[model samples]
Target: MPEGHTIHRLAQDYAEAFAGTEVRVTSPQGKFSDAADLLTGGRLTRTDAHGKHLFLGFGPAGHPTPAESIPARPAAPGRAAPGPATAPAPAAQDHDDPDHDDTAPSGWVHIHLGLFGKVAFGPVPAPPPADTVRLRLVNDTAHVDLRGPTTCALITAPEKRAVHDRLGPDPLREDADPGAAHRRISRSRTTVAALLMDQKVIAGVGNVYRAEVLFRHGIDPYRPGRDITPAEWDALWSDLVDLMREGVRANRIDTVRPEHTPEAMGRPPRVDDHGGEVYVYRRAHLPCLLCGTPVRTAGLAARNLFWCPTCQQR
Candidate 1:
């Protein structure tokens, strides 16, 4: 499944490419025909993201989202929307609302690409879409195609709010609050590894992040959330903020420290289907980066858990 970083980059890419322009929305596979009709010919007001969910709002092309319309409010309006765990800051405080334009009742199209979902973007006059294509959005200059997504539906404002209400905070957004996530984890007796994958506790964390972040913090994946100290939780959340940010900018998930990269370690780059360099994640039985201890793996929450026994011996 595409993680939060990938979703965030989609939000950024779509906003820059399609927002503020009228788009020809269509369902090449006919699965999203109704949803496409709702957005067809409407200007993409904004692109919003929450954890694994993506929301695209439709309205007049130039109708400034309260933030961009007013000159007195010197704030940038384009940012990821809040999820269930986050509430938008007061409109009076900042202009960064998630494309909450006051026009067009078509509202937002909520998209959740589970595991196989993919969106392909290219220059204007999009080429023939694949048979599995679910949705397509095109402007005069650029276009994007969606396929294999677990969800592609037209939703109302209230429905969007409801979706956000069910998710935990996302670290990629400026308004994300780690305190609430910490509180949720503090009360759970489940293993920290499993809890990290729970969207309700901390949105956007997946199997890869769960393994890499735990390994990065040197915390035993088997450790119960209740047994974790607040200080440890803080460090974990902080590291995610930093690492996930890099993932968004670089458009890939690279979780090794500067000293541990392939060049620094004088070793070959990672060889995995995921397309990134990771530490203990899929390196079971291999030598640990910091120590010679053999990395190990086990099944946890139906996902493979990886770690260095010596480094994360907690």
Candidate 2:
């Protein structure tokens, strides 16, 4: 699964490229034609994400008018309507937002690049392959292909409401409450590793963040969440906020400190690529940057867990 950082970047890129403009939505593979029709030609008002899910909303225009009141104009005289035009469709609102007019709704296409899914941006004429193309969105200057996403949907206001209702607060969201996260963590008896991956407890955190956070506070991953002290939980939350923010800004996750230069840190640590960049994720048996203790690994919750045994002692 692409971690929270990757999803966050996808959301940012989409919000910048496509929000507030009419998008040509299509399911190249024809598997998502029904969902695509709900989105084709609709202005992408906003792009939002929660944990592993990406929500993209499309409708006739202006902030999605009530489904029952949108004026469904007759199809362009002779041109047949491509798909079902739901309730009342809004008038074609001009893209005149003084704040951003040049940008197109190229990026607002919600994508959940699951484990094998990914996205690419550029003027390249051809994409990876048609077999892999799930969804494609285009504007005058850009093209976005959602390849291999595990889940893709054309959500409406009510569907979006349901998604948020079930998700835990995302650490990256401006309104995230660490106090709430602490309360949840303090209540779980699950291992720290499992707790970290629970979307209902904290959104956007994955295995990498889990290991880094545990190591930063010198907490053992095997420890039950309830066994973690309040002070330790406080430090974990602070560290995670700082770390996740840095990731959002850099578009990459940097778990190691600069002082621990790659060279000074010794050999380029081995990691299970798993199709992602890494530090301690798979650097098992490698030396810890802060201490000489060798990094260790084991399976937890069916996912590989990495740690510096000596540094993150029980």
Candidate 3:
């Protein structure tokens, strides 16, 4: 399954390409004919994502707020000085904002690309694969195809609320609260591996990040979440935010540092970088990047879990 980073990136791309545009929505696959009608001729106001769920908000004549609407500003002063008679400082505003509520369609559509789903953008003149196309949204300049998505529907405000209510904190959201995720995970007696995979515990974390985070923190996946110290949990969340941010920017999960690349310099290939750019993921039975111990793998939560026995001892 595509991780949170991938979903976040997709949301960003969709927002840029289709948001604020009146799109001709269609169900080429015919499975979503009813949902397509609710979205056809609707304007895409914004694209929002939480964990693995992607919400594409469509509004009527009024444009929906873009994700960038909530610009991050410094906290306001606790109390404005009692006397503001003097020239009041110009009202603070986010100058960096480039978003606008432009003329567009008024409708809403939401899609969740479960595991194998993907989207592609092309000019309207170009043709798309008719067979695999699940949904298509087009404007004058561009068209987006939703292929293989697990869920694609026209969602009302109440429906969106219900979906968000079921999810835990999403690390990719700007307003995400790691403390909430930490507290939730801390209460679970489930194995850290299984707990990490639970969307309700922390949205957007998949098997890859799960194994990598545990290995990075030297925490055993077999350990119960309740056994993890609060400080450790905090560190895990912090590290995940950092790692996930990198993944979003790079569009790939890279646990190994570039300097660690085997052909990076004059040095001969390092054993770990024989194939290059990973610590243990898919490098099972290979030598560890930190210690030279052979990387090991085992089945955890029905997925292959990789780690260095020496580096991540129980």
TM per prediction: 0.88, 0.78, 0.81
Candidate 1 lDDT tens digits, 1-314: 88988887787677767767788989989988987876788887656778898877776446544333211111223644332222221111122234663443347788999988998889967788887789888888998999899988888777887887788988876667899998988888999999999999888988888899999988999898988898999999999988887777667889999899999999999988887889887888999999989999999878888888789967
Tens digits of per-residue lDDT, candidate 2, 181-263, equal 77877788888888888888888788888887888778788888888787887788777777776675556676766556456
Clashes of 3: 7
**lDDT of candidate model 3 versus the reference:** 0.69
Model 2 C-alpha RMSD vs. true structure (Å) is 11.4
Which candidate would rank higher by TM-score, 1 or 2? 1
**1-314 per-residue lDDT for model 3 (tens digits):** 78887777676666667766777878788888887787777677656677888767666534554444321212223534222211111111111122432422233466789877888888877485587788888888888888999988776655666776788777766556778877877788988888888888788888778878888888877888888888988888887887776676566776656666665633454343222256677778877767889988898767888878888765
- Segments of candidate 2 deviating more than 4 angstroms: 61-111, 124-129, 263-279
Candidate 3 all-Cα RMSD? 8.9
Residue 263 of model 2 has an lDDT of 60
**lDDT score at residue 50, model 2, on the 0-100 scale:** 63
Give, for candidate 3, the lowest lDDT window spanning 10 residues. Answer: 87-96
Would you list the C-alpha lDDT of every candidate in the order shown? 0.78, 0.64, 0.69
Candidate 3, 310: how far from true, in Å? Answer: 0.7
**Candidate 1: stretches off by over 4 Å:** 60-62, 65-106
Q: After superposition on all CA atoms, what RMSD does each candidate show versus the true structure?
A: 5.7, 11.4, 8.9
